[model samples]
Target: MSGSDVRMSAWGAVGLVAGREVSTRVRSKAFLATTGVTLLVLVAFTLVMKFLGGTGGADATVGFAGQTSVLEASLKATATSVGQEVETRAVADEARGREQVSDGDLDALLVGDGTSIQVVVKEELDAELRTALTVLAGNIELNQQIVDLGGDPGQVNQRVSQAAIDVRPIEAPRDFNGEQMVLGMVAGILIYMSLLINGQSVAQGVVEEKSSRVVELLLATIRPWQLMAGKVLGIGAVGLLQMGVIGGVGMGLAMAVGALTIEVSAAVGTVVWLVVWFLLGFVAYSLVFAALAALVSRQEDVGGVIMPPLLLVILGYVLGISILPGDPGNRLVEVLSMVPLFAPMLMPMRLAMGGVPAWQAGLAVVLVAALIPALVWLSGRVYRNAVMRSGAKVKLTDALRSA
Candidate 1:
């Protein structure tokens, strides 16, 4: 009986192929090792950020000698106001404080007659530390001047501290912060790795089947597009599982350890958007990968055949990684992010950073969504025409022109 006249339905054939791919891939040692290493790194990072010493420690340590210890609170407040964390320690005397500074135990030593701020450093103070000390020194002079002029130092200092510059922005962002920016970069990394790994997996799988003459036998029972679709969907399903596990576990662990100060909902939202973009990007890119891969029978030829589409993936990732972390709202990046080719990698990063308009996000999704059907038709044609023609690289023109 002919393969088409067999008992199985078309969907059944696709499912069988997909199931085989999923079973084969998940059993591989490389997948298990990579996933395990990723989890361990995520967990280790969370631990270090929360419990172990990370950036949470003070930036500089200042030693106070004698009566200068009275200025501890004020000096610390000044440093904190400028986003510098200063740890204050009491010293027995100027001699000991200088010793500590020289030994690098203290960043600077504060020693004076309690009348003004004085600093002794091993060499020069850090620029940020210098800024903090300068502000504190100026405040001391201003306070003493106020006292001599018969004005209340406390009241004057309070007013000066309360004063702040007011700025009015033309357009306010919907939601954006340092935390969100970090999440955006993480999202970009996850999507980029996912696309690169899984897309290449599809290509290699295609070339492997073709090079081994396995495609001939598979085509005897299943249609070319079904086999291609099944492989893509199957590998994508496994990759999606990996992405969810890694993202969900990492973010969940970060939240659980209190390492992440952002709202829980924000973290969850980032994970959801990450998964969405991965799915969109994988399906979109893998189609082209499979098609291009079919043009090459040998595994060695796969890279060259797939380089053009691979460049698109790399370009989107590079642009998003390079630009979004610094300028989330670059006009060029924002515009390119809307294009279907770039949307899969760039849009997710933008979404994590927030301030992406609802309409714009929706439109990017729609654009990529619209591109898939065209890819399916075009890619299916190339794969069908080229998959059975082994031993030499198939030209695109010939693939397209074949009946």
Candidate 2:
């Protein structure tokens, strides 16, 4: 066979092995069950957040005294504007309102004494209700001042209208603060969790193959690089499929429940970037994990092999959290976000929060992409050297020297 034919056959063999591994994993019941559970939890949490955001309406009882029916109507209108459903009760006197407030019969009592207003809440009143009462009182006072200055109530109402703010996200297209934070946290968690889960799987698979003396038999049929590449790709494919299913279900549920108000186009773009970043991050980490796995001949040595990668993931997560609330343009943050190991966590967050410039984000992506080939080359050398060595755990320095 020609050299070209040999290369093609080798690649074909690698693809077949990868396909077999992916098929085996996908057929496992654990995979299906875990994906379903993840989808359900994501949907349920999103719905709960929507429910808690006053989408279902409030059930607070408010008492009013020393104000006419017109004033009560105005108060109700003001409360409704702030997403509160005020069940207004006209008290016979301020004393009666105070008594109701104290007796737990009312959430709050509003006493308007001409120019001054007092809001009385029970010690057990809901914190949200108390805050809303304060806000409503301020609105009332502002309206009174407008009227005192001969300003029309209609004009004041127009001036004080609270409309929904439409968010046009530049990089990551989350519609609200909840969605932005949720997506960022979820992305970071998935990166960390996937690395741990799949990395362990790779290590355990290697140990099992080694302990069972299957590696010697397999080595006769395929090259070591092909074996390693096939395993990594297959497991990476499984991870991607699981992530895609969960993400699609989540997006649909979010839209259905009105938890997400962003445009579908924008959401799709964000998911595309997520998948792109996941692939890059997984490839980089999984190769290192597989190389680490090959360094140990026994299952007992797996922890020592995997600890460094796990620690790196944890450090990235901590750094991502700390930088999330600050300006992403800070010198340290920019440097960390560009580092390939930390980029998966920090870059996604910075993108979501509109923290990173487009050029910087592109540059970070390019840097990560450039680093992958070097990592792959290094990991391939480590795996070839250590996979055949049968003994105590191999040191990282020895693996590098072997390269």
Highest lDDT scorer: 1
Extract clashing residue pairs from model 2. Answer: none
In candidate 2, what are the lDDT values of residues 291-358, reduced to their tens digit? Answer: 89888888888888788887887788788776665444456766888888788767766665444567
TM-score of 1: 0.89
lDDT of 1 by residue, 171-252 (tens): 9856578768877887888898999999999999999999999999999988999999999999999999998999999888
How much lDDT does candidate 2 score?
Answer: 0.75
Q: After superposition, how far is residue 135 of candidate 1 from its true place, in Å?
A: 2.1
lDDT of each: 0.89, 0.75
Clashing pairs in 1: none
Which candidate gets the maximum TM-score versus the true structure? 1
User: Candidate 2: where are CA atoms >4 Å away?
Assistant: 1-8, 55-106, 118-176, 322-331
For model 1, the superposed segments whose C-alpha errors exceed 4 Å read 1-6, 48-55, 90-105, 122-124, 174-178
